[model samples]
Target chain A: MTADILLQAVIGGLLMGLIYALVAAGLSLIFGLMDVVNFAHGELLMVAMFATFSLWQLTGLDPLMVLPLVVVLMFALGVAIYHGLIARALTVQFNRGMVQIFVTFGLGIFIRGLAQFFYGGEFRSITGGMVANRTVQMAGIYVPLPQFAASLVCLGAFALLLVISRTEFGRALEATREDRDAVALIGINRDHIFAIGWGLGAATVGIAGVMLATFYYVSPNVGANFATIAYVTVALGGFGSLGGALVAGLLIGEIEALTALVLEPSLKQVGMFVVYLAVVLFRPRGLFGRL
Target chain B: MEAIPDNAITRRRRNELRCALAVLVVLAILPLPISDVYTQNLIILTLFYAGLSQAWNILGGTCGQISLGHAFYFGVGAYTSTMLFTHLGIPPTLGMFAGGAMGGLMALLIGWPCFRLSGHYYVIATFVVGEIGSLLFLNWDWIGGASGLYIPFHGESWINLQFRTAKLPWHYLFLTFAAATWLVAWLIDGSRWGFAWRAVRDDVVAARSLGVSVFRSKMAAAVISGFFTGLGGALYGQFVGYIDPDSMMTGSLSVLISLPAVLGGVGTLWGPVVGAAILIPVRELSSTFLGGSGRGVDLMLYGAMIVLVALARPQGLVSLLALVRGGRNARTA
Candidate 1:
């Protein structure tokens, strides 16, 4: 029975870890592309979730059906943010780093406020969605169908990202990441690449948001908690490394699950934090992060 | 590189001291005429945040380490003093010092490992550490847990730092606190340690090559910054008369502590005071007028202002003072 319970936790953790990997990938992509860490990355996820919720409410469509629309909307938002705020922030003469941090932070607060203004602070969940309240039995362990599907979708998204890396646009992105200024010498518009990078980052997170909306609760404050986890994942995975994000996400998810079983459920996050601190102290650059 | 003459530096320091003293005097008298509790409360909050922001500036601005987890120290300070008073029958006035010491200790502990990481890694580590702290506190039942601790009424007393019927006392107390922080900053501005800190902040590699101990410099700044922030937290706990994990240690509180310094002019002596002076009033008034309905209009306005200021005045609002002085003294007014 104990072995069964442990096995169940491991499966559950891996499923959740996949979703975390997707979220962290978006952040890692943006950071890798430009040394800018998007403080508002989670808010983008929140917006996507809300978009999915709103669409479902309006048209009676399944969250799966609304995923494409939400992804497109989030992509537009990501581009708009780059041109409207980040572009200007990058040009500031003094306190460039501080300015970038606050600009994105302020944008996040503004987004959260806007969400609260429109939707109040109540927690809303999709009640009768396609995967609602369903469980799959596998070898004496029960897995929630919604989470299982979300993990699969996230893995597929990761594959798509890998596929994109072989395309012309991906080459431009890699070259830009290598040396943004040098890429300009080769006729690559750095600004245009940055905007597209932001869009791609947002779209990836949007995919995760739509999947999460199928199972998770939707609220104005939901993003804050997930954002914290994403930060930990990114740092632990080594910032800007997609593979690092995946491995670290799974590790964190497993640690969290085991901690919940050994300690109280409320203290589950402590395990992940402790592990992150330990790893960071030993290897300052994280496991896979490049200098 | 031409070195600034000793007399010129001394003259600037003296001028700053005189201006600061004059401003304090004016503030000390300004609250006297306003008998209204609301305005007095606003002034008190502004002064309190001014002090807190100044404390944050020590490490965040002067030392060039951006910690998004200061709420950890604040919460630690609050919990330490509150627990001392409630369980051990100690007066908060003395307990506050203990809280400050604990705050410093915590900073050293956190900084020991975190100082190795630079830039975003360091920032995220601080943030995560803070979250860990708040979560742990929330679950721990010994110090009242999520329900929080309420200070019992012991009537009005200077020793206890509690006053039920007087806004005037709180205003003066906070003013004194803010003045103390400002005084400390002024002293640090000309000290040898200050120059070393600035060097480390500007470029660690260069500073190290120049024989400056980067790790020790950051640790020292962290200890001092944590001490003051924790002290401010203890005072805030007393003022509010209640303490909880959410109230004392949330991520938003950490951001709020840093915002004033960021907005006014990071690393400048007067930046926190000016930023708090403008920010607290706007925050209080907007929340009272627009946020009462909970429609989040006040938050929207607040966020928008931060974005606008950060974008428009990257050097901070204090630089505007330089601009107004004909732009002759641009870097440090």
Candidate 2:
């Protein structure tokens, strides 16, 4: 029985971890390239989830079906945020770093507050999601169908990201991050790359939102719930590496779930935070992050 | 010619002191006419934040290490005194110092490891530390768990730091803290420690080459900043008479604490106070305008303000004053 429980916990953790990895990828990409940590990344995720929820509620469509629509809308958000806030923050001369932090932090507050104002602070979910209620029984372990589907979608998204990152455009984007002046000398506009990076970052969260909406509740404050974990995942995975984020996310989820079973359920966050602090202290570069 | 420059420097210092004193004096008298509890409450909040921002400025402003998690120290202070009062019947005046020490310990725990990470990465480390703190507090039932601890209303006494009826005492108490914090920051701004911090801020490699222990200096600044922030938290606990992990030391509170220094001016003594002055009023007006329970609009406004300020005016509100003063000086010359 104990073995079965542990197995389930591990599986559950992996499932949740995939979404977390996907979530952190967006943040990592933006921070890696632009040097602007969008404190509003999670908020954008929340908005995308809300959009997914709204789409389902209105059109009575499946969560997966709404992915393309949500992705487009989220891309617009990412681009808009870049043009509107991130671009300006990057160019500002004095204390540009501090200014960038405030810009994003403020944007976070603004989005969260607006979400609450419009949505009324209540948690809502897609009750009619295609697969949430159904569970598959495999060798005495139950895997919820919605979670399974979400995991599959998350895998697909990660693979797509891999494909995108290896393309000629991806190389150019990377070149911009490596050396802006060097890239510009080679006739590449870093500004456009940064905007695209931000857009991709926001869109990554949008995809996470779609998968998440299938199984998790969405609310204005929901962004806060996921943000810390995403940050921990990104930091642990070593800042700029997508694969590292995926591995770290799974590890964290497993740790959280296993700790809950071994010690106490309430201390799940405590366990993760301890690990996060320790990792940051020991390896500031993170698992795969460039020093 | 050398004596003339010295005389001019002294005169400028004197003028600055005079301006600071004039502002404080005006603040002290202005509370007299405001008899309403709400207005007094606003003054108390403004001053409390003013103090909190100054405390943040010590590390964030001077040392160039942006701590997004000073709320951890604030929570430590609030919990220390309140816990002592709730469990052992100790008054907050004595407990406040204890709280400060506890906050220092907390800072040490966070700063020791986090000093390795520079810039926004360090900020992220602070956030994680704060998360751990609140989570621990949330689980520990002895501190009242998630429901949080409440300080019972005792009769009015200066020693206990308890005042039941009027907001005047609370206003002045916070005012003293705000003023004292400013004084501390001013002193630090002039002291060797402040120089060390600025040295680190400008260039860590250069500062290290100059034989300065960048780690030790940053750590010292963090400890002092944490201690003062804890003291401020102690005052906030006494005045509010209630505390919770979320309200006292969570992520939101951390953002609120950092905003003042960021918006006001980090290194400048007057910048934080001025930022608090502007924000507190804006906070009150927005909440009122939105009709008591307007969800998210106030936050949106604050967000808009931060973004606008950061993008257009990274120098903070104090820079505007400097510009005006420079213009005046130019015209006079």
Candidate 3:
């Protein structure tokens, strides 16, 4: 009986982990390429979730169907933010680190405030036809349909990212990551590449956001939880390592789920953080991360 | 080194003179005649944040260690000192140091492993410390778990630092701590260790080549910062006379500690002080004007301010002040 519960926890966690992978992958890309932490990444996700909530309420559109629109909107916003804000910041490298941090952190809080301002703190979600309240019964175990859809979305997003990065645009981003000056010297638009990287990063969160609304409550504080968890995911997977983020996300999800099953649910997050510590201490490079 | 430019130096000194006088005049007389309990409470809160942020600046603003888990020390200090006062009837004045010591020890223990990692990894380690501390506080039977520990409201004693009256004591005490922290920042600015810290901040490899033990230096910084922050925590708990894990150890508290330093112009002596001066008032205003969602509104406004600040004066108010002072072109090692 214990074994069965543990297996269920693992499976459930892995599914959630895949979604985390989607969230962190874009973050890793931006960090790897431009070295921008995008402290507002989770907020971006929150914004997307809010958007989905609005769209669902108005048009009764399925959150999944709205994913592409959210991605487009977020991508454009990311580009604008990079050009308007981040570009000005790169001028002085001296205090750039703190500047970036405070800038993004402030942006995050501001976004949350905006959500609270407009949304009025009510929890909203995109619950379409069968997926909203329906559960899938598999071998006497019940799994929410939204959870499964979220996982599929996670896998799809990851696959899409893998392809993009392996393609020309991705190669250019990798080149930019290696050295901005060299990339510029080779006549590549490094700034443009960085903007694209940010856009891509934001777009991924858009995808993650809409899916999150399908299964989870969307509110002003929605991103707060994701923000820390993403940090843990990115750290556990190693900074700037996409593959490591993918694996770490799943692992954390599994750990959180299993811990919740055995212990109190609130403590599951605490357990994930402990795992993050242990991973950082013992294997800072992460399981699949490149040195 | 270039020939000591006496004339230019004196001119810069004169520029700083006006600014310093203005600040001193404001600080000296502002507390007087403001017997309004609300203003006193705001002042006390401002100074509390100023002290915490200044202590945080020692490591984060200076070395760029980016500690998001600083509340670990704050929560620990608050809990420990409060526990001693409540359970053992020990005076909090002495118990505060005990809290600081425990916080310092934890920092060393945690920092030892974390300092080995770079950048975001270090941040995650700090976050974990905070969560673990929260977990311990919540689950442990002793010292009041999730329900929280309350310092005695009836105990009106200076030794225990408890008072039944208004916010005057808290205002004065926190202001003193803030002043002391600034004094320490000034001392650090001229110290050999300060030079080493700046070196480590600018270039670790070069500093390492000069025989500066990078790990030891960072660890020292973490401990120093943690110690004062723990003291701030203890004082905060005393003022409120209530301590809880969530209020003390969460990221919200972490943001409160770090924001002032960032807003004030990090890596400078007066950065946190300026941050507290500017940001806290805005927060209070937003809270009053906005209401119910005042906290949320403040966050949005604060965020917009940060983005604007980053875009325009990324170095913050102190750096801008330094520029206006016409200090010889800012130099970085």
Candidate 4:
């Protein structure tokens, strides 16, 4: 009897884990390249969700249809945030390290405030979307339609990342991560590569946001939830490792889902936080962290 | 070692004594003239923040370990005292110290594993741990769970720390803590432990080579910081007469506590007080005037201020004061 509940939880967690992986991948990539933890990353996802929600309200386009627009817009915004704020902070000379951390955090607050200011503090949810209220039955189990679409999008993001890595830009980004000074010597522009990485990292939130619009509620503070989860994922997965984020994201999802299955649903977050603490305490570099 | 001239040292000490006295006079008298509950509460809240931020400043400013989870300690302060008072019928006056001890112990437990990380990793770890603590508190039904524990208010009594009319008692209590926090920080600025903390903060590798135990110093800073902050929390909970996990132990509270130190100056003794002095009034005013529909405006301003400080003047507003004073006084010296 409990087998059905267990199977459902496992399948549900697996589906969710992939999306978590997608959300965290950008943060991992950004840390991987720049060592700059994008503290405002979850805000970017929040912005993307709002963009998709607004598109639905105004133009009558579903989140799936508005995904491209949100992605492109978020990418541009991410680029601007970096060059405008982060770049300025880096040039401060003496206390660059502390300044770098707080700049993103400050930006995070500012963005959340902007969202609240413009949209008001009310929680908004999309009324109808491409993948709403539909599910598929497989072997006496049902799969939510939007979540299925979300998993597909997650896969697409990974494939796209794979494709991107083979490109010159990815190589430049990798080089920059390896040695910023050496890359500067090689005639490949460090600024462009880093900015693009930042932009792409932000753009991935678009994929996450559009999916979340189908299933979750949207508010200014919603970003804080995803932001913390993403940070935990990045930390658990090993800072700066995309593949690790993917695996760790799934593992966290599984733990969370399994904990909910066995224990109270309210305490589900305990599982991942404990795991994250263990990771930070014992193997901070994480399982697949680079030597 | 270079020795200071007797006259010069006395002159500086006299000037410092005068400044402290002037501040003391102002704080002592501010609530006297203002009988309005709103203004009194604002002063108490602002001072509360000042103390909390200074507590944060110990680890954050002195050791350069930015913890986004001090709220966990704050919540612990509130919860620990509330539990002791509610379960054992012990007065909050005595419960305050016990709560502080709990906070210190919690800080040690949290910081022991956390100090291993530095920079971004450390921040993330602290953040996770804070959330973990908060989640555990929220789920545990033994401590009143999500509804939060409420401290019963009695007729105006010193032991109960409750008042029927005047807010002066609470204001004085808060002022005392803030002043104590400032004084402790001032003392630590000259102590060997303080030197060790600053040494480790400035350069851990160099500090280690200089025979400083980076771990021990950070642990001490965190413990003391949490202990004092927990005391402030007990005062805050008693002053407010209610306690909740979400309200006390959340990221927003963490950010609120740290913002003052960030805006004022991370490493300075009086930065938290000065930062709170400047920002809290603005926050209070914004929330009062534009707060109804324009919610998040205060937060937006805070965010902007943080970004402004980080990008423009990482030295903090206290440095600006110092710059002005030094600029003017340079001619005399």
TM of each candidate vs. truth: 0.98, 0.97, 0.93, 0.95
Better of 1 and 2 by DockQ: 1
Off by over 4 Å in 4: B1-18
What candidate 2 gets wrong by more than 4 Å, as runs, is B1-11, B291-294
Model 4 per-residue lDDT tens digits across residues A156-273: 9988998888888778878898998798787988888878888999898778888888778889988888888888888888877878988998998898899897678888888888
2 versus 3: better TM-score goes to = 2
Q: Which stretches of model 1 miss by more than 4 angstroms?
A: B327-333
- What digit string (tens of lDDT, one per residue) describes model 1 on residues A1-291? 389899999998999989888999999999999888899988998999999999999899988888889989988999999999999998999999999999999889889889999999899988767887899998888999999989999999999999888899999999999999999999999999999999999999999999999999998878887888898999998998989999998998898888888988878999999999999999887888988
The DockQ-derived docking category for candidate 2 is medium
lDDT of 2 by residue, B149-246 (tens): 88998899888899999788888899899988888887787677878899999899999999899999988998999998998898898988889997
What's the distance in Å from true for residue B277, model 2? 0.6
Error at B161, model 2, angstroms: 1.1
Q: What DockQ number belongs to candidate 4?
A: 0.70
lDDT of 3 by residue, B1-333 (tens): 779776875665555456555765676577888988877778778887888899999988776688888998998888878888888878889988888877777788888888988766676678767877788788876777888887887567778788778566666778778877776766676667888888988899999999888998889888888888888888889888788888988877887798888878888878898888888877877777775654477667777887776667767777777686565544431
Candidate whose TM-score is highest: 1
TM-score of chain B of 4: 0.94
Query: For model 2 chain B, where is the 10-residue window of minimal lDDT?
Result: B1-10
Sort by DockQ, best first: 1, 2, 4, 3
* Model 3 error, position B55 (Å): 0.8
- 10 residues in a row with least lDDT, candidate 2 chain A: A262-271
Which 10 successive residues of model 4 chain A have the least lDDT summed? A90-99
